[model samples]
Target: MKPSIPPPPTQEDEALIKDYLLHRMLQTVLERDIQIFKTLELTMTNLYILNLQHIIKRMSDPYWTVKHQIRQRGIRIESKSWTPEGEIQVLYLCRGYQRSLLCSWPPMKEELKDRIISYLGTDLAAY
Candidate 1:
């Protein structure tokens, strides 16, 4: 008997897989950041801001086309409340949006920690 080949994935299947991978990647990034924050005494709000800045700086185009597109999709780029917890909440809300962009169009190869330091404009070696 000959072995049978599996059928190719449909568009729906592909979409589901893509969504799963995107969420998994976002979760992994968040977990790693939380662990680093624990050691560096960073708050959830700081993590949220760092991630937000990275997304804006890295994802936006000169014409603001990408930014506008994401905004149209109801992604929260700014925090509405003036509290750390609120910022953290916004961060969680932005996770799917960030991951969607990151998944469909990956940015340059840079670690989250390095990006955070760069965003802070601080020289770690000096510390």
Candidate 2:
């Protein structure tokens, strides 16, 4: 006995298949776009929280003031922070610039500390 072949698809069947495939493709694209949008929203939120431009400006004054000291001691900016305690702390490294410095500038007034930390979207503990 010979094997039987299936009947060819009708035009209506072909149209239905095309429609189903197009629908699936559109759904896939929509899902991908939604994920991308979510990621963008998260990144924007973080950026808003950071407010990086203002943070940079806040650090600039102290950096300029200590630049001469830095040159003399070969100390470099290891880490820096405008702490929630209202202190401008910069970990300056010296001795071939590999050691953490224990020095910190005097704390700003308590009110200022509170304001800065609030704007930074974090508390002292978070910092």
Worst 10-residue lDDT window, candidate 2: 99-108
User: Which pairs in model 2 have colliding backbones?
Assistant: none
30-116: candidate 1 lDDT, tens digit per residue? 567655665674456676656654644543342255334434444443331224322211221232333221222333123434554
lDDT of 2 by residue, 72-113 (tens): 544445564556765444454353434332223332234335
Q: Cα RMSD to native, each candidate?
A: 14.7, 30.7
Each prediction's whole-model lDDT (CA) = 0.42, 0.44
Question: Relative to the unseen true structure, what is the C-alpha lDDT of residue 2 in candidate 2, on a scale of 0 to 100?
Answer: 100
Clashes of 1: 0
TM-score of 1: 0.31
How far is 44's C-alpha from truth in model 1 (Å)?
7.3
